[model samples]
Target: MNLNRFCYFLLALAAAGSLFTPHPWVMWLLLVNMLTVVVYGGDKMAARKAWRRVPEITLLMFGLVGGWPGAIAGQQLFRHKTQKQPFKAYFIVSVILNISVLLAIYQLYPFSSFFTS
Candidate 1:
């Protein structure tokens, strides 16, 4: 199988495994972050090789949900997509939006029912 397909398959496998775990939400976030890092690295490699690149929307969506930390780490580690136009702004916005939503959810529901279930 190709690298892209392999990466997605692993991500899907992680999600499926997380569903049966006691801490599914935590597991999902960890998986997402790790996947985000890998994806960033893959994109960097693709750029260098002149291969098809990962979509910008996919990267932004990953950060928008729960992978901002990994996104930051990937940026520093891979030195990829760090100085692009508008994309940088979009990534920052996604991080802020994700944190804002999480904070809002926490304030509204301290126990986080999603975590319990």
Candidate 2:
């Protein structure tokens, strides 16, 4: 298979694996990531069709909400938003901010709290 398809396949496998995990947030993240991928694909198609495109802010919001993995994968698979200067810069910032927030949360809360009620 091609590299893009391979990447998507890997992501799908990871998503499937998350189903058995005890952490509810893992499932949430997987769902959000899948949604992000769909949004990115839709935006790419819209751009090709000369239709109204998804806003950069919306894309960034998805990434900020823990969809960066899918966003990056979408960028590669769809060849979307990888070249725009402002969007690229903001996308990187969003990913960094998201990771930082996740790290902070992990540091502040015990690991069990993330999964336990």
Candidate 3:
């Protein structure tokens, strides 16, 4: 497989991994992978102009809904980070925001307490 496809596969694996682990560390890894794709892929002109304009909200939604891996991988595979503009900024911001939200919820929620009662 090409480097692009390989990168995407890694991203998918990361995303799938997040679903099973409760640790915030997993999300961190996924975030790193996504950021890597966004930065490197954008610099290399990997995707299209229109697709590169994908909104930060979309990325945030994906991360929030447990699809960070796919979203990140899709960006790299589709070469959707060419715009060196909003795509990069929005992606980074959204990933950080999403991870923060997930971590916050995990720590504050009474998940274990409720399950035991």
Candidate 4:
């Protein structure tokens, strides 16, 4: 299988694990995955000039759906980051969207609202 695809699979598993565990361990796993992808992707993007041709918006969408790390890795491995305009903008927007969702969840539901009182 494609290494990038494999990494993404692992990321998905890790993210889903968080839903069940909701522990620091799971969060750590998620963070590691995300950071790995981001740093690696940045390096890859730096190498390739195809930055303008790729669609970071699609990648960002993946990130929003617990695929950010994979997107990051794909960006690097594919060497798709050099054009600084759209990629950066879309990346930021993706991050903001994720953060907003997190904040909304925290503020709207301090505890388990899906369960009993």
- Candidate 4 Cα errors over 4 Å, as ranges: 16-29, 32-35, 38-83, 111-117
Error of 1 at 111 (Å): 3.4
Candidate topping lDDT: 1
Instruction: Quote the lDDT for 90 in model 4.
Output: 77
Which 10 consecutive residues of model 1 have the lowest summed lDDT?
Answer: 2-11
- The pairs that clash in candidate 2 are none
Q: Which stretches of candidate 3 lie above 4 Å from their native place? A: 1-60, 110-117
Candidate 3: 10-residue stretch with minimal lDDT: 46-55
Comparing candidate 1 with candidate 4, which one achieves the higher TM-score? Answer: 1
Candidate lDDT scores, in order, read 0.87, 0.81, 0.55, 0.57
lDDT of 1: 0.87
Candidates 1 and 3 compared by TM-score, better number: 1
For residues 11-103, write the lDDT of model 4, one tens digit per residue.
566656666654644464466557446645654564464443223444555567545556556665765553577776777677678778767
Off by over 4 Å in 2: 1-22
Put the candidates in TM-score order, highest first. Answer: 1, 2, 4, 3
What TM-score, to 2 decimals, does candidate 3 have? 0.42
